[model samples]
Structure formats: structure tokens, C-alpha cells
Target: MLIKRVFNNNVALTEDLDHTEMVVMGKGLAFQKRPGDEIDTEKIEKTFITPSEGFANKLSELLDEIPYEIMVLAKDIIEMATSELNTELNDSLYLSLADHIHFALTRLKDGIPIKNALMWEVQKFYKDEYQVARKVLELIEARTGQRLPEDESASIALHLFNARQDCSRMEETVKMTAIVGDISDIVKYHYSINFDVESMNYSRFITHLRYFAYRMLRGELNDDQNDMLYEQVKMQYPEAFECSRKVQAYLEREYQMQMTKDELAYFMIHIQRVTSREKS
Candidate 1:
């Protein structure tokens, strides 16, 4: 590949045969190199193919700011997450994760640690992602010799979780997490029961809440008028139905998003399963 730009001695921007921009990385790969110079394929350690010019620009800017090691660490973590999670993540994760870890390390070095408020919720609700994040923390510590606070795991988990979704903004993920926690709280209080987070029913409930929150944020309302099924569920599981109503009210009051009867019916089904399992 011919170099279009050089960010540093170890990184350069190049284009493939299709004229797609890619950031190539290696030790001393760009040393004494100029734009239009041919890249040494043997020295190349990693290449990030930019899907868009906007993304390429943003990534180029980020590369100039953060340490190359941070970029590599983020790449390794993302690769591990992809293998462990068995999912294709958005390419933007490379930029966001590298930026986050760079700042997080800087904050720790300056003794300005940030607390993740959703730590408990993230750990309980996103077990698989959280586990991968914990492993990431260990990886970070091993590479940098900086042991970040446990809360950082939740933050990393959020990044991993957001990477799996269709949403591009981290704010949406945070909001969805908060909504899930709030709805879970409403169910707990309404039924006077604590959820067994390890239970299959509880896992199903959390998954339902996550999708519900996603739909709510996107304004993808369930408009199907399943009146008969709704009434049948309401009568069959009266207590859980009441709890779902409370959750519906909470969402409406707090988020100003109305839940449809179809959503309510499905919500009631999950609630009934979880609460019944908890009681038994």
C-alpha cells in the first residue's frame, strides 16, 4: 500500500487497491517515510480499514493524540471481545475504546479516578459483557502496570455492550442501562422480591428490558393491537400484570414514552416467570 499520510513513526494512512483508506500500524513502519512512499508489508502489525471518510478523519485525529500502545491495547481487547462474544461489532469501537482507555489511564495517573454509577446494574444485567470487561481490565493492568479501579470494568463493559448494538452513541447505552435498572427496581418493589440474577428467568427478564429500552429510545412502538392476548395475560397473571402496569407508568412518567398493550403483555409474561421463579 502507498502511504497517503504518516501519523507517526509507527503509524501511517494508506489506501488499498479499491481506494479505501486504511490506517496501518507497526514499529518504525513509517520511519523516514513520506506521503506516497510504499509501505513495508513485513513491518505491518495491524491495519484498520476505515469504512467512511468521516471515520477515517476522526481515527487519524485520535491516533495523533493517543499513545500507539493504547491503540494496540484497545485493538487487542476488541479482538478478544469479538472472539468471546461471537458477534460482529461496529468499527467505531476502535476509536472510542482507545480514546476512553487513554483518558482513563491519564485520569488514574493524575489521581482523578471516575466512578461508574451503573457498576452494580452492569455487573448484574450484562453478565457476559461484564466478564469480558473484567478480563480486559486484567489485560490493561498487565500491559500498563496500572490497575484501574473496579468501576472501570463497568465502563469498559458499557463500551463492549454498546459496540454490540446498532446504536452509535454511548449516551443511548447509558440511558438504556438506567432505564433497565429503574424498571427492575419497579418490579422488585412492586412484588417485594429480590431477583435471582443468576436464574434463567431473570436473564430472560433483563434481555426483555434491554430490547424494550432500545425500542423506546428509537420510538419503535409496538402498535399491534393484541387486545385479546393482553386481556388473557392480564387475567392469568394478575399480580405480574399489576407490576407491569407500574413499570409502564414509571417509563411514561420518567421518560415520557408510552408503552403499548402488546409490550405490556410481553412484559407481564417475563415478569410472571421471574417473580414466580423467585417465589418458588
Candidate 2:
């Protein structure tokens, strides 16, 4: 590919044979190069193919200002998250995360620390992603010699979660976080048991809660289907059903949302699994 514009010795903007614009990153790839110069394919470290023209332009601007290493780090983080979560992330993560990380480090250097209000919920619901985000902070400090606050982990986890859901707004992600946090607290207090947050049951419960919260916020509900399972669940796991009822009440009062009986049946099942030992 020929360079259409050179950002620096290591980065350039080029168009593919299909006339699709791409941001290319590599060490010394554009050294002494001008527009129309051929890009050394062997030196290409990364090429971004963004769906949005506006985001592509923003990414190009970011590439011009950020270091190549920082950009590569963001790409690596995205790859790791994709593999670990087994989800296709939004490509906007490349521009959004890289830009956030660069500025986060800058803020740290300026002695300005930002706290993530949803850190507790992020850690509890998105445990794996939150762990990876914490490790990313260590990686950032190791590479940049600038240490960010612990809250940054929650920020990173939010980005990972947002990418997973292909969410369009940060507000939606925050609302999801808050809903999960509230639901978790309700369950914990209702049962008076500290959830074994590391257990498989707890992990599965959190996963359920994430989508449950998303649906609640979006006003989505399961279709009304008369089923015997709700009666069976109430009989087999009365305490769990009661807890689920309390949760449903909380949701109704807080969010003005109601759960269908079919929804409550599945919720009772999850509640039973997670709170079974306590019941015993």
C-alpha cells in the first residue's frame, strides 16, 4: 500500500486496493517517506480498519499524537480481552481505549486522580475483566513509569464491557453497573450470606445479573408463557423464590419495572444455586 499521509516515522495513513482507508503503525515505516511512497509490508505492526469514517479520522488524529508503543498496548489489550471473553469487541475500542489510556497516564503525571464510582460493581460483576484491567494498570506503570489510581481498573473494565455489548453510550454501561450492584446487594442482604464470589455459581449469577440488568434498563421482558416451572420452583425452593420476590420488588420500586413469572422462575433457579449452601 502507498502512504497517503505520514504521521511520523512509525505511522501513516494509507488506502487499500479497495480504496478503504487504514491507519498503519510500525517502527520507522514512514521514515523519510512522502505521500505515494510504498509502505514496507514487513514493517507493518498494525492496521486499523474502522467501520465509521468519523472514528477512523479520530483514530488517525490519535495516532498522530500518541506513541506507537501505547497504541500497540491498547491493541494487545483488545486481543487479550477478545480471547479471554470469546467476544468480538467493537473496533472503536482501538481509538477509545488508546485515547483514554494516554490521557489517564497524563492525568496521573499531573497528580490528578479520578475515582470510578462503579468500581465495586465492576469488580463483582465483571470479575475477570476487572482482573485483567488491574493487570493492565501494572503494565502501564511498568512501561510508562507513571502509576494510575486503582479506580482506573474499573474504568478499563467498563471499556471492555462496553466493547463486549457494542454499547453506544457510556451512560448505558454505568446504568448497567448500578443495576447489577443494587441487585447484588439486595440478594446478599436478603440471604444474609456473603456470596462466594469466586464460585462457579456466583460467576454464573453475575453473568445472569448483567444481562438481566441490561434487559431491565431497556424495558425488555420475556414473553408471557404459562408454565408449570414457576409453581415447581416455588415449591422446591421456597426461600429462593421469596428472595427473588424481594428482588423483583426492589426492581419495581427503584426502576418502575416488573418481572414476568417466567423471568422469576429462572431467577429463582439461579438464586437457589447460589444460595443453596446457605439454605442447607
Cα RMSDs of all predictions? 11.1, 11.3
For candidate 2, the 10 contiguous residues with the lowest summed lDDT are: 218-227
| Local distance difference test, candidate 1 | 0.86
List candidate 2 stretches off by more than 4 Å: 165-212, 215-280
Number of the top lDDT candidate: 1
**Clash number for each model:** 0, 0
Residue pairs with backbone overlap in model 1 = none
Per-residue lDDT value at 131 in model 2: 86
| lDDT tens readout by residue for model 1, 146-190 | 999999999898888878845656899899999999989999988
Tens digits of per-residue lDDT for model 2 on 215-273?
Answer: 66776566565479889888999988889999999888888887888888878988888
